[model samples]
Target: MTGNPTSRDYNKASVLDVLLSRAPLTRIELIELTGFSKSTVSRAVEELRADGCVVNGGVDEVTGRGRRSTYLDVPGTMGHVVGISFGMRTTCVLVADLRGRELRHVIVPTVDHQEVRNAAEWLVGLMAEASKSAEGPLRQVVVAVPGRVLGGTEIFGPAESMKVFAGPGLQRALADLVNAPVLLDSDANASLLEILTDDATLEDAALFSMSSSLSFASCIDRELLRRRTPAFGDIGVLFSGVGNEVLDGLLSTSGLLRFARGRGLDLERIDDLWLHPHEEVSRADVLDAFTTAMVTAVSAVAVTLDPGSVFFVGRLRPLVDEVLPEVRRRLDKSLATAPEVKAPTQVLGLSVARGAVYACLGMARDRLRDAVLEARRQGQHTEQSAPAF
Candidate 1:
């Protein structure tokens, strides 16, 4: 038969999470904040300290106290984690502490974008320079790519995309270079997590990334939706036209430019749609088509996830003010219930990289808690197996 449920596990995790987020708390403060019994707080803190997960920060200064109290904190010397994002034109690397505070961040042009395999050495060199301030070996390294990552090894997308990770050698090289565990995630998925950090209201939402390829990440009840198919976010290639055309060819930045040219607007790039306001009348038709296609994809997401909110991320972010009204207008005419549409307010370059760092921080915290519990259990087993007195 199995032993009793690990019910106290919840309490331990709660206490540890608070400590990791805001440490150097006195016993009285922990007892008050955690709502745990005074004795329970003492015991938990003792066990955590014994496991080297928490350390005593000396006695707190008290002018009128009957007795000085000890403060406990998660030491900054615990370890560090790194998050990297590989985009179409640029690659961003971030080094952060276990608590997710940024120690360093660096952005560099992506070398040989079509052939990342040839630039593996350059990528490693960039990461090394970015992580120079790391106190010690990284606890985790999370890499976010513009394409889908399968089985933590293979990557799939357009031929000229982030296909370097499609092979296992690059992943292995990154792990070896950093001397840490590595995680691979889609850029859309990472961006989703980053958006949630700004507001607790976004428990469930969908992230629409309008980049080189159209992709999205859906979250339900604060948990990301995981799929087994690489085609889940391949909205770019989704069949649209009668014959050979696809969604990306109809609404992407490049696609909008092509549509404008067909209308004799003479626009060379998507940014021209906004940079030249005087030509707005000429490009109106192209904007209308762009908005229509974007709304159709968003409508599909709303029907599929019915999330509490839908966020616009990536390249299309700059076009939020220009297109939000149209997106809302279309959603109102189509859906029975349209979710709130939002654009990122924070200007953290490369949200995917920041999200990866956020995810790694969570993983590091959980692992540290598990290590403490395991150590405590072993200590108990040692006591039980000792010779009789």
Candidate 2:
């Protein structure tokens, strides 16, 4: 009403940001955190309900109030979220609930810098198959790419090469195929969000993804400090190398197979994983050199950011199940006391896709919080302006 954009939108948005970040809170709690009066909180809640943004949950038993203080939940039917992650030889797809829960996941084969058209078409087909099984309302789609993205935020997708996929290239392609509002992000950033949700140490931490093609980094928190900053060491080039010595050029299935052939091991003839797994890796003294690379990355992140924790994502987790031990062992050998090394392990085996779902959930119900605050403000004004004796 004041014609100033910051008027109530600011208050409403702050209120929503808090609510969505945590479970439901009573008006008293919201008032204390938001600095708004109980009257304002109540008005916002009522307005949210009217707008169909917040759901009227059942009673609150802990407070022992005479009447139930209506709890709030984001309207689940607002839309659908999808997550995609890619590597040199594999790709992952995930669907999530409005709350960001992974409803399902699918993994497929891929190639390096695979053709854009092939990737887009495959995504369309997968979503179609998923919709056949979906039972609830769906809208709003988000995508995660495994490179640095060119945008206001640099969560994952490689920031340098992402210019190729940025703007209309990917969003327009996906939108034309899926017919929904699409947002792109660095897949590693999405993975970081998934890990932060479960890793307590990650209350303030960073995740370094050591995968084929390129490595990515993400700093995590309940709230972003700088979102993406330079201090968070960038390691993409090291992963996707230029010549034969490149990590991606060595560890990728093709790379590994090439290395095996040079060592007289017929990788094409033998299913190395199922048959001679030992011979497949004994090509050189680099027994789990990738593990060392990952450990080195973690140690670097530790000394650099002193993040509460760090996680190793991508193919490294599965290949070297002993990654935590290996990382700690290396860190211990390097430092006098390794900053109280704790578990950097996580089960985001398919987290990027889950992050996509979370991105959507955060987007959909994310606004419910504002609607609640708006209602509370209106209620306060109504009561305050009433005639008094």
Candidate 3:
């Protein structure tokens, strides 16, 4: 049976997440903040310490009673979480801890592209290298792809451009190579999640990435609004031939090629093209596209969720800055009647990889909490069921 989330599981994982995000907290503080029982909190903390997942951070000087007890800290190298972004051109591999700090990385050319065989062979080798080096075994892999994946199928899917993953058993084949649980998500979705990094304060945001190909992803109320074709945000497709069009038409590679040429860079193809946000040459072109695209994308969001901000997370930041002024100008021009679109358009690098870890780590943490809590509940039920002497 597929495991669905329980309220208890979410609560327990959230507790661990908060404790790990900041400095140590006393059992009293944890109880008050997490609304967990002192006894239950003690057990959880003890289990965390036993697993070596947490340690004594420091003692509270303000607490006058007793030893003032120490708080828990999640150290580096706690567990291995792998993030793979297989773009149109390159395969970027990053392995990190539960807190999302790097352990070892293997970033090589995208010689494989969409070919399952090519990617699987190269990735298998990379996995072996990572496994041998880590003190702990690989726990999970969160792979982000730059295409539309729907119904758990990777080939002949919504992403019409590339067909490399069209081969048989893409997920299973990769899992066989890594020997760990693997989670697959769209590059846009993964980038969006990675950039956000479980920050609940962020309610609504959209990310535009020119990694493998030009694409966008948006989240509303912190929940990813999905579709059958893994489609979240498609401003490139939407802004095509629209009013004062600035973005490349999704149906036209020539449009993207021309867009590249407009900035004085003639990239042969979108394969592994790392769109920088700061390069002066491409700055003007990117900004024009960013302005039109952001206006269209944010306009869509405005009509729906009306978010706080839109963050752009990718490799190129300076190039992104060039576009921000224009993006703001367009947003102002188009949404004159809509709610004020004042949120800054951000360009965050390597955020997608980090977000992938948080997403997967959150799941893994929830799983561990459930395993322990279920055992406790079972024990309690057994005690109540026993006959009295």
Maximum-TM-score candidate:
1
List ranges where model 3 is wrong by over 4 Å. Answer: 1-29, 47-69, 73-78, 99-101, 131-137, 151-162, 166-168, 198-200, 229-235, 242-255, 260-290, 313-320, 337-349, 376-389
For candidate 2, write residues 1-389 as lDDT tens digits. 21332345456556556665553666667787889877766676564455444565555786654766656665554345666664444567777655554566777765333445656687777766665545355555767765555442233334333334434465666777775567776656677777666656546666555453344544645543333443233453344222344454343334444545665665663236334555544543343554555555555556766766565565545544544576577777886556443434544436676666676667656544444334444553422332010
Predictions ranked by lDDT, top down?
1, 3, 2
Worst ten in a row by lDDT for model 2? 380-389
lDDT of 3 by residue, 187-293 (tens): 66777776466466777776656543456667777887666754434455555434455453422344545565656765665322344334565745544554555
Candidate with more favorable, higher lDDT: 1 or 3: 1
lDDT of each: 0.70, 0.54, 0.58
- Return the TM-score for candidate 2, rounded to 2 decimals: 0.69
* lDDT for residue 321 in candidate 2, whole number 0-100: 52
Clashes of each: 1, 17, 11
Q: How large an RMSD does model 3 have? A: 6.5
Candidate 1 lDDT, 1-389, residue by residue in tens:
22322535446656777788667788888988899998777766765565455788789777974899888887666778888887776788888877677888898776764454456567677778987887755788788776666655556773245545575666776666656787777777888888776567778788876666656688988888877877777777765432344667655555555667777886666677677763666666666666666676677778777887888776656666688897898788888899888877644345688988988888887776665445334443311232010
Model 2 C-alpha lDDT versus the unseen true structure = 0.54
